[model samples]
Target chain A: MKNIRMKVARTEMDLSQEELAKQVGVSRQTIGLIELGKYNPSLNLCIAICKTLSKTLDDLFWED
Target chain B: MKSFFQRNKVKDERITNLQNKIYREIFLIVAAICVLSLIIKQLNHGYSEANIWTEAVILLVSSFYYMIRSTGLGIFSAEVELHNQASKRSMAFKNIVFGLLFGIGIGTFFGIRSAVLYADSTLQSIYYFLLVSLVSFIIYIPFLIVVVGITYLAAKKRSDRAVEKELEDDQDQDEHK
Candidate 1:
């Protein structure tokens, strides 16, 4: 789980890491790590993030 | 946030001080029990009959001291601390209750087996009591260690979860504007 995809998503949505963290129910540090590909969110947290972004888990979280 | 951190630090320090005091008191009581037992043994010239009354007195005193000492530590005042302590108390209580139940069940089964399979005698009855008491205390040691370990881990995990949840909730509420 690298941050490349999270960074891409954030850039596409024009949302800051802090803004995304609020929408998805996580700490800003958590969002930073997600963008930096450091911390892996739990399944529930991943779903919450996907829902907040109007995306699918596979679309936002799945790795190539 | 700064005051919250400071308050938690103060709570940690106060709890630590109280815990140390409790430990010191327990240690002193144990030492006193050992000393009293030694004095009794020496005064009896090392060749006296078993003094059941004296032993019972010692047991009662020690048990009462332990109970009072534990109670005096007082309840955790902070909500977070209370939650952590409650989980610990419940886990420890469960471990003690379950361990004692299991030990008694096993001891009774063995005692019954020995009595039925062999000669049923007064000596055997005494032997059964001794064996069961020794085995039960030994069995309790591992359970005590495990219960303490699990309680510590659970409290730490819960506290971490609470802080994380608080941070998350604060952010969520901020965003609702």
Candidate 2:
């Protein structure tokens, strides 16, 4: 499933996918893929994304 | 100094993963092509040392490079750890089976080459093939098993130490926090 939570968190932080990806030290395409659920980010990458968006892992990645 | 390729490279996990996958696929394809070409040459011209040396060198050099790099990086140990967790069969047993298959392949290749070169008749060819194959198998099997086993054990030891160190470092950080 698409990571709607992460997308929302990024947007709430006033970040585009490119901006979030740059902050996380990944490519814009990778950020897009992650949001689309086409690629699973490694834990380190997930942590970095969470930090960039000011979100906890549970807030951005955990499924209810 | 960074090379042109390195200078322009993107520092992305997905890109790294894609590059690794591409490298593996290309290596396999190249190796397969080389093997097929060698077989075709052998069929048409019979076994000649000249026909095989280039392909053998290419395959051996690439394999050795990959093995050395992976071993140095503890990838082999990580793979063994993953394998142990995911599979019922032990890595050592898998290694032994691999060694056996490799030994048989090499033995057969040498046997066929020698038979083609030195045997005078059909009966003599068959005799030489079996004799050489058995000898080669006997020589390679034990050597491969021992060498591979030692390498696996040493890599595992290194990986275990690295993991322990990481755990200790994490604990130290937790205490500081």
Candidate 3:
């Protein structure tokens, strides 16, 4: 259930969880939780994360 | 320009969640210590109303401080709304239930204390406990219901207004942009 795709995208962008969280106006722990599949973010937050990572929701959040 | 308090305020949801969790734990620890101390005092020197005053004051002050802060931050109303929505319960009903439970807890505590202190025989103690508990419950239930219900309504109104203002501000910013 971990968001491996999102983690990959973030690493590819050379962004740490803290840096990505700052960009999304959230805490590092929130980003970590999302990646760890421990938290389900609001659509607004999801959109914000997608925008920051330059990825679509399907690319990062969709379960195949 | 950000005020000193505003500048240092934490805006992150996760941090706020963690802080609330920690605060609850700390409050529980303090409450346990106060109860332990009260028990120790009662055992050593018998039941004096003065012995309870310190613990009562500490508990009341902490509760009031938390309520004020949560209300100011709109967290109290939001939490109440969330709980009511999730449980599919009306706010008034929930408040009444809360009042009743609170009354029962206080009544039980006072009943036990009075029974222990004033009753000479076991039968008398049982009689005293029931009488005192019933009286305390009757006195506190209505008072708490009215007070808590009014406070919740007022806080919810304030929170709604704040949310509206924030939406208007956002709309204004979008228009300006």
Candidate 4:
């Protein structure tokens, strides 16, 4: 349940969920959960994902 | 940046390692069951038959099980980062629930044991069972309160420390830039 910001950023970066999960060392399911809004990643994880995708935390994770 | 990510990734690995420690998990479950069995056996077989070694094993196993289980569960319960406010609150709630549930279980076991050992008839045993259970619940309430309070406070403090560290890291990164 990825937020729109995250999904859009990852897609724009040409990174699949699996690739992002691999970069961050989390399972695919965890990424999926985060995407689906079923789970929230920790600060470290959020930072990792943002780094891998070349996005800021606000760009990928900020909620309206 | 590499070092920062590596450090945090180490934290993640530590958690994943514990989650994957199946042998320890099995040992913990088995030891807990053994402790319960020992208590039950003592009630049924009488305290005179309770060997000191049995008590020793129960204590040792219980301490290990509790230490590992609580830490592991706390770390692995949610994937949220350790410093997050929600993570802290969630851990606090989890600790409280675990403590209360453990108290209830111990109380029920001891209550039933008391009833079984003292009562001569089945009906009397059943009545004693209920009475003792209620008494056990009452006895455990104060202890549960203390335990839950301490756990929540400790978790909150740790969360604060983690957040402080995160902020410090951010500052360091800004300085580097």
Maximum-DockQ candidate: 4
Q: Per-residue lDDT for B50-150 in model 2, tens only? A: 98998999898998787666665545555665566567999988987887788889999889988999999999999999999999999987888787778
Q: Any runs in candidate 4 off by more than 4 Å, and if so which?
A: A1-64, B1-89, B172-177
Q: What is the lDDT of candidate 1?
A: 0.59
Order of models, best TM-score first: 2, 3, 4, 1
**TM-scores of all candidate predictions against the true structure:** 0.28, 0.55, 0.54, 0.45
TM-score, first chain, each model = 0.82, 0.95, 0.97, 0.90
* Lowest summed lDDT window (length 10), candidate 4 chain B: B168-177
Q: What is the lDDT for A56 in model 1?
A: 83
Model 1: per-residue lDDT, tens digit, B1-177?
Answer: 476456543356557779999998986786687668767775776534454456556666876665444333221112333343436565445545665676666666665555555636878866866676567557755675566556545554654554454334222332233
Predictions' DockQ, in order: 0.04, 0.05, 0.04, 0.06
Q: Where does candidate 1 chain B have its weakest 10-residue lDDT segment?
A: B70-79
lDDT of 4 by residue, B1-177 (tens): 467456543456566767779777886787777778777777777666445476667767777566455444343222333323334466556766777787788779877997878999999988888888878878885688677768667654554454343233221221122
**DockQ of candidate 2 against the true complex:** 0.05
- C-alpha RMSD between model 1 and the true structure: 15.5
Residues A1-64 of candidate 2 have per-residue lDDT tens digits of 7788887787677787656655676655457667767678889999999888888999988988
Candidate 3: Cα lDDT at B36: 93
CAPRI accuracy category, model 1: incorrect
Interface RMSD of each: 10.5, 14.9, 13.0, 12.6
Ranking by lDDT: 3, 2, 4, 1
Q: What interface root-mean-square deviation (Å) does model 2 yield? A: 14.9
> What fraction of the true Cα-Cα contacts (under 8 Å, chains A to B) does candidate 2 also have?
0.00
CA-lDDT, candidates in order: 0.59, 0.75, 0.77, 0.66
- Candidate 3 lDDT over residue span B116-139, tens digit each: 999999999999999999999899
C-alpha RMSD by candidate, in order:
15.5, 11.4, 11.7, 11.5
